[model samples]
Target chain A: MANLTTKLGRLQMKNPVMTASGTFGYGTEYSDFMDLSRIGGIIVKGTTLRERQGNQYPRMAETASGMLNAVGLQNKGVNYFIEHIYPTIKDLDTNVIVNVSGSEIDDYVKTAEIINELDKIPGIELNISCPNVKEGGMAFGVSCAAAAKVVSAVRKVYDKELIVKLSPNVTDIAEIAKAVEDAGADSISLINTLLGMAINSKTRKPMLSTITGGLSGPAVKPIALRMVWQVTHAVKVPVVGLGGIMNATDAIEFMLAGATAIQVGTANFIDPAISEKIVEGINDYLDTNNFSSVTEIIGALEI
Target chain B: MKKFILDLQITHKVQLNKQNVLLKLTSKDLLPEILPGQFAEIRVDKSPTTFLRRPISINFVDIAQNELWLLVQIVGEGTKRMAEMNPGDLLNAIIPLGNTFTIPTDKNAKVVLIGGGVGVAPLYMFGEKLNRMGYKCVFLLGARSQSDLLLLNEFEKIGEVYTTTEDGSHGEKGYVTQHSLLYNPDFNYIYTCGPTPMMKAVASYAAKNEIFCEVSLENMMGCGIGACLCCVTDTTEGNLCVCTEGPVFNINKLKWQI
Candidate 1:
């Protein structure tokens, strides 16, 4: 078998098949379908400083080859995670990263500091790109200045590996990536979900309770690939790519586009066992191509 | 319960009507112990417009024959595709997802199962369970018309079946709540599944009469697990996932207007 190990700054993965935030619950949810240890990493749901009830009902709309969601970070706050969720996932063999979000800079810093104390958690994916929430979320992600400010603030208190997750709603994602990298982000993961909307012609109303929601799935793959390619060239920090990554081929495409590691997002909803299947698919691809290590393909695109 | 994702082969397909189709699926191994009111997330392959797996309720589980039945209503692209499957086709599904309805201990307790349209799907299995346990079952089914009503013969075999059609072509000339049978006294418990408005009306009736009631919600879902958090319903406890916490819930816990 070809070596499948990959790293994003200090965060090393057995394979590059990490699950995107909001898709995979605490690693325990899928323990029945596949071995949780088989995954490279599991980014738990977005945890904010305060409890959030999230958006109203009818929060998801299925589009062609994609789906839209306005589930605005509905979590029981970080304390709930530490007290109730942490103990269960702490012993998992794979990397259990927390996806942290906030309405203010202090919220991000405080939450990150708490997660930094957890021995099992090696990294935090700073979520500045959740489009569903009313405050903070995508607000800090759209502007390079705001993105850098949040990352730098969290950097002061968070001692673990800091991976800033970038939003695709902005005009120049590469500029935002560079700003976060300069602000002390150990790594950058991109293309969080594209802002889009769906409408019901008959009802003359929007499909989702929130008129607009974040779009993810195969439909956003091309845009995600282009952004990953652009940001990888512009930033110095390692990049984790994700957008419509359905299978191993999609994961390989992200690696080729200069992503140090890749994440599988919306596809997890379709197939619970997808992440492990991708780990196997990546190994199969490496063996067939005669590549010695999975890292050899990072940014190996001829063009 | 431990959930299993299995490739169940289609043993039979019966088109009940233009809008509804009943599919019987079985696997080589014995099917998992599925409770009434639970559902399956069936993967819709080859359908370009359909992205997520369709959450279809478990209509019936014929244990002796090792068959799991799914009564599908062709409402959209995903279900329309499910209706086109032939016998011998392989359908992948995540079975036994969500909480089951409460089976009361008192066999003599008055129980009524109310359903409307394909909402009657889950009640069939539930009624069967109640009947097998020596509880007399009364089913009050509703449809738009006589032809719109489904599984009348099958439901009749297990319970005292009563129905209402909007066009007055069935037992009653109005909604299920408008039927004269609901006027009967001493209905200790009621279980219903149907459209939101219909369930609300049933909840209202049950609430007004001070009877214990439960209703099944058919909310738009993603990932048929707690992970997606898309199918959350407002309840007394707060926003809870309908998929994991319940496809079935006690009326008292729900924050319905009634």
Candidate 2:
């Protein structure tokens, strides 16, 4: 049997198939469809310092192989998560990682600091790459210096496995990844949704209410894989690759491209059981290849 | 709030018009109680463009036979592929989603149902349920013409049906709200679903007369569950998921332009 265990700094995962934040709500929403404890980890929706109503109506638009979303991280704040959400998920067998988002640097630090106090949560995935919000999301993620500033500030207040999620809307993604690594980020996840948009010709208006939105789905796998490979070589920290991974084969491709772990995003909308299936698929691939451990496949690209 | 994912086999497919088809499907397990205005998220596998499931309102449900009905209109890649499907083919669906319409409980409550275009799908089930409960049911159905109007015979069995065609080929001329039946002040409750403009007009009229009204919204949805905040309809309370909080909501809850 192949060992599916994976470790990123201090945090360890049962498998490497974590559900992307925002796509999987609070870890409990998908309990009706599949077992939450079976997957690697569950990253709850992006939480801020205060309650957010998010963007206005008509926030999503469907494109050719994927969809565009401007959901703007609509959560009931970090305090709400501590008061209501944390207790329910605290005892779940799988690792519970919180995806922290904020409109300001202090909000990010405060949210991370609160999550750090939770005993059950082993890490916080710093979401510096959300494109939908009007301020401070992709702004911090776009530049290497800005990315390092947020990671270093949060690292001082929180002492858990800090995975910095990177945005693809930049000139050089590997440079940003290295900057976060240098600033004490435990690991890195890339690339957050690529910035894109669509237009309705008949109405002559932009499809999303926000005019432009972050794009995710099968359309972004090649770019995500390319970045994962580059970032893996550029940084010593582990890389969690996620873009438009839909199935097991897609997940395997990410692992081969040097991703230490993989997060399933828009694919969860298509199939809620995709993360579980990916875990099983990874085990099956390892068994077929006569590899005793899943790590052998990481960064195993022939090129 | 029970949810079931079933591989339903197509038993019958009837092309109602140039754009619409009535599909009949049967599942192995007994279906749970499904209310009027609730919908099923159908997975369209054939089309690459349709990665997310399509939310279609339940037209009818036969508990005894474990049969389900969906009225699909060929409006996009998903429905276009669904239209080409033949009998004996399989369809995967998540069912019994969203909230139901408020069933009239008062002894003297008179109800009117208004539907436009493919929006008329859920009204048959609503009318049938109301008819079973001994309530007076009336319908104001709108279409492009006599040929565009669907299931008048099915609706007539449960209610007094009135229709309007855009080209004046049917009952009353002009839009559904312009029909003479709407002018009558007898109805105490109004239910509407269809094009946004038509529902808005009906909702406005209902609000003006102080009648209880509800409208089912068909927003662009990703996950039929509340997780993906994609299909949200703005309401007085906040932005609520159309897939969960409603496909059915009282007009009072909705903050429409009217």
* Docking quality (DockQ) for each candidate: 0.91, 0.67
lDDT (Cα, tens digit) per residue for candidate 1, span B14-37: 999999999999989999999999
What is the DockQ (computed on Cα atoms) for candidate 2?
A: 0.67
Q: What range of 10 consecutive residues in model 2 chain A has the weakest lDDT sum?
A: A25-34
Residues A1-303, model 2: lDDT tens digits: 699998977888888889999898877877877889999999888999999888887899888888999998888899999999998999999989999999899999999998999999999999999999999999999998888999999999999999999999998998999999999999999989999999999999999999999999988889988999999999999999999998888998999999989999898887777788889988889999899998899999997
**Overall lDDT per candidate, in order of appearance:** 0.94, 0.90
The segments of candidate 1 whose C-alpha lies over 4 angstroms from its true place after superposition are: none
Query: After TM-score superposition, what is the CA distance of residue B152 in candidate 1 from its true location, in Å?
Result: 0.9
Model 1, span A1-303: residue lDDT tens = 999988889988899889999999886878889999998999999999989999999999999999999999999999999999999999999999999999999999999999989999999999999999888999999998999999999999998899999999988988999999999999999889899999999999999999999999999999999999999999889999999999999999999999999999999988999999999999999999999999999999897
lDDT of 1 at A44: 93
